[model samples]
Target chain A: MTIAEQVGAPRIVPGRGIPYPCGDPNLPPAAERQWRRQLVQRALDAVAVAVEHPTIFEVDDVNA
Target chain B: MRIVHYVNQFYAGLGGEDSAGIGARVLKGTVGPGRLLAQLLGAEHDIVATLVCGDDHAASHTTAAPELLKMAQAAGADLLVAGPAFGSGRYGLACARLAAVAQAAGLPALAAMHPDNPGISEAGDAPVIAAGATAREMRPSVQRLAAAVTKLAAGEALTAADGRVIQAARVGQLVEQRAAARAVELVLRRLGGDREATEVPVGGFGVVDPAAPVDKAASVTVALVTEGAVVPAGNPDRLESARASRWLRYPVEGADTLASGAWESVDGGFATTAANADPNRLLPLDAARALEREGAIGRLHGEFLTTVGNGTPVATARRFGVEWAAQLRKAGVQAAILTAT
Candidate 1:
């Protein structure tokens, strides 16, 4: 994320971690897929929104 | 010290631009500027051999450096000096390539060229003495090369004061004061209106105008891209485990999800156990397919581009991004989801 900020990626969507960026294996299979879906949805939404600078599109902010 | 000098056809007195296609060959002793360099080094160094190749040939032939270095090593040359190439792009590139090859072979090597030569980037960690833009500055350039050669042969570090081009690699050096003291002093100086008193200068990434928001998301084709190093089971393209120099694309057409046994993450920076257990964790192809089916996006671009980003240089990454963006644009991709690890 710091690298993303430093490089000034115009649309940035924060991911989970270095190991599994999208899906959380700890979650139940169905819930995990739903979580992954929301993450992808957030990324999609990020591309649809215009920003003046490197802006972080938080996954949890999807509902907010 | 025994030296092997490299020069292009023009410098070798072979011919002008007409001789540009001449191949690599060796002459027993000093040729052209090598004579001046020899005189500069005085009685201590011997110009054992001169390796001459046409600029066109050197730029095009991959085998030239190794073949020439072999002859140099056979001649028992201890140091390799290539070019006061000045502003000749191809010659400078050849010189830089030779320096890289010589250094890799455990030979002390140095090159002299104009600082703006495109070859400087390919010189690796080899010492490059800054030269002027043309042959008119040959005398000083060779003199600088001679001094640099003496230092390198004696296992001494060349400093910026020696007119060495600033190499891309950051080298650690011991300073008079500790880092904390230096930091505090810099802060105090800045607070006192010395705005330029920075220990390290930061270069900007340059401003990039943001692409306009997708007017109709559901009508656009979105592509998946990753620096996560996801590839087929055996990594058929042999994608590097780290510091990848290239990127490869794989077709995800008609695939609903990436199967664990069929795909894996080869990135060396992180533990791949989780990603290997579920390849989609790195690529999220399954989620993308679901979105496509749901009409959340008009289409998922048929292929996903992958490359290992672990320890990759920013310049290399930028190049990959530029090339991938071009390819995506050509494929009619409206937007992309780039997953980084």
Candidate 2:
């Protein structure tokens, strides 16, 4: 996350980790896919919004 | 002090660009600009031998440096000097390489070139005296080289104040306080309204103005790019698992999702077991494709670009970004989703 900020990524959405950025292996296949869908959707929404600087778009903020 | 000088064929009075294919050879002494340089260094410095190499030959061959250094050592050289190559790219690079080899061989060395020369990056801590853009500034360039040599021969440290190009490397210095104590002091200073109390200064990466927001996500072609090292099964293009010098693109025109057996993550920075089991976790191709179908996006780009980011230099990453962005723009890609690991 700090790496993204340091590199000045304009619209940042936090990822799970290095191994599974979109999906969680701990979840069931269906749940994993659903979680991935949400994460990816958040990324899509991030691109649609304009940002003045490197801004983090939290999943909670997106959900709200 | 006995000095051995390195110069390109042109500077050695051995013809012009047509002679660039000629291999390395040694001239007896004081070829072309070496005479001016010798005069600038005064009577104490003797340019014992002049090593002349064709730019084309020097740029392509790595074996030349050690051989040339041997010749210099045989000539009883106390110092190795390479061009004030000025704006010439190949010559500057050759000079920089020679300086590096000389330093490793325990022969003190100095190179002169324009600071913006691409060779500056290859210089590796060797002193590079700032020169003008072309030979038109030869006098000043030689003067700077002479001044640097005088100090070096006397066992003096060359600093930026001496007109030596400071390399983009960190110099270690012993500090009186421990790291934890320093950190606490810095924080306390900052809390006490010292806004600029930073021990480490962040730089190098330049600010990029954010691109305008996608006016309509449902009508733009979005491409997926990744540093997750997702490549075709068997790693067909052989995208490096670490410090990737290049990026590869795989066709996904007819594919709905990245199947487990069809693609895998080979990034060396992290364990790939999870990503290999489900490549889409790193690329999110399945999710992206679904989003396209659901009208969240207009369409998916036919191919996705991938490269390993593990331990890759920032400059290389920036170059890849620029090239990819140009290619994407040419393909009418309005935006890109770059996934990183």
Candidate 3:
């Protein structure tokens, strides 16, 4: 559970942390870029759907 | 261009929490993050002075705005850039207060602070570039604010699309449609037992508890306000096509009515031809005047506030109401009739 879950944020895009929540710093730079892009895209898509209740999106692929 | 920078004690390379009580002081050149803003501003703009003040001192009632503005003027500054104050509540308030003072002194200022900061809500009409919750987002915040400052110096209208400045509210682009046509369609759909969308959110079920009913409608002064962007034909103030931050007050002091061609609608979201040809359509002052003549109301406020309702966010709408209501209250207008398009 994320802070969004803890606080019951009406909407949440799960990639979170103090730093590098979505992408691991130890990962190869190229892989990190891919990981961050997909995470951001999910956040964008999540904004389009209006939700009265808390919802968290999981981004795996760019199109996901 | 001479640019005056502002920072708190810590960013001024002074002591941290211990230095929170320091009085206002002016440094010769860019300190701390002003260097970064300078790099973004390039060599064309001089980071002429960095005015430092303690967060507590700046936030408290000690009064330093006049002197700080005098310092900026003495430096011959063309613009003032204050901190991207992040989530520091006091620091954000300080930057916002300084921004307002600079604007009053004929210098455009830009600052940044997180949306979560209480200062942002109290920032008045001062435009703040969005910042993150901590210094970790400092670079991006500075970059955005510098970009906003550059655009502002060039006298450009920076809207929500610009990605730099954050308006109090954020509204998305909407397709144009007549209210009558949409309403008919919604009615038909609902009759067919299908869910229908609404033009305005009526979560309160389109029901509003009326204000304590005026005891004597004929005795109260009433004010007219509109979000229809109706104004004198020249469009002098150049309010944004969207995401507007300010409103214009058109004095209706003696005029009994608005004549066609004397006023026009500049709202970008809707068809303005009709509203322009007949300004009273968006702002029903003519009708109100008739009501006043019929002894329905005692007086009509001299001036009315007008702003663009097109694509305005709820927060920004609330902001406009707060400011406009204060002005109306000060004028002793006991009642108001607000219209929106």
Candidate 4:
């Protein structure tokens, strides 16, 4: 959301996913950093916003 | 040649939650995912800097977005990239927002995300989202999206993300109904109805009891004029073409000051100045305070809400309003009536 606000970009806030935001603090440094980087990068690419059902942890094909 | 990368606390080398308390920083190049993205680009792109901030800090500061604009301007990055943010909602939303900000500023924005990531749809066409999921997938995703960016930078056309970026069609540009309209007479003929209209214009059908009369001695009615005429005659709010608008809210101040219309226009003809210069900007604050003083309302909300609505997608605009309303509620605001100029 900060990124959106920073760019004065428009975005929809989804209901609670992670307050600290991406990458659980409990993980080891290297793994945690990698996870954090990926999530942040993916977010940078998002041009739209939306919510979801289970909210997190989903599986399936790319086109699905 | 330069690119600015935005990342969450953890990616900025700020430790996780426990360390996430750390401050924000700007770096020279790819730290973690930045490195991967650089590699993915090969020799095609040059990422000059990375700006990392605690998600909380970015989320709380009203001035943060403006601060980011300054940072991007200072960096002079031709391209801006945010996170791919697989499933983290806030981070993902942040990425999408930054992309819009950059795009609004006339820079191409690129980000990656899982197909199911919800922020992609909510952000409303600010970033060029590439396919893939999970951090382990960064290399390829960045590579692909960056390729698209290069193509764009070169003034070359490229195939779209297929369906990755959830794009909204322009208003009045029939989306779901894409087929051309049938002949006017043929369509009107089909719409012709033989039966009389059955519905009433109003919905309230319950009987009304006798109206309670107000005592002349006890009743008082207060009228407040918060004529917040924030306009940039030509609606300069629309900073760019419909697709890439880096919105900059130039204030419309001073109700007494006379101005001429030039930058843009809406249905009304009032001239628009940069939001920072407009005298009408004071109208809301002035009115809110006066209303509060008169006991018409308990308190005035701090800082009038502002945004450049030109070329803004309906979904994102609605989201912004809802989010703003929620925040106002937390601050004890119960109701608000917005007047758009």
Better of 2 and 3 by TM-score: 2
Q: After superposition, how far is residue A37 of candidate 3 from its true place, in Å?
A: 59
Clashing pairs in 2: none
User: By TM-score, is 3 or 4 better?
Assistant: 3
Query: What order do you get sorting by TM-score, best first?
Result: 1, 2, 3, 4
DockQ of 2: 0.57
TM-score of chain B of each: 0.54, 0.56, 0.50, 0.48
Chain A vs native chain A, TM-score per candidate? 0.78, 0.81, 0.74, 0.41
Stretches of model 1 off by over 4 angstroms after superposition: A1-3, A60-64, B1-204
Clashing pairs in 3: none
Better of 2 and 3 by DockQ: 2
Top lDDT hit: 1
Model 2 misplaced regions, further than 4 Å: A60-64, B1-203
Candidate 1 lDDT, B13-87, residue by residue in tens: 999767876888999999999999999998988999999988767765668788888888988989999999997
Q: List fnat per candidate, in order.
A: 0.75, 0.74, 0.00, 0.00
State the lDDT at B200 in candidate 3. Answer: 67
The lDDT per prediction is 0.85, 0.84, 0.69, 0.47
Cα distance off (Å), candidate 2, residue A20 = 1.0
Worst 10 residues of 1 chain B by lDDT: B318-327
**lDDT digits (tens) for residues A1-64 of candidate 2:** 4888988999887877879888779888987888888887787788899999999876652322
Better of 1 and 3 by lDDT: 1
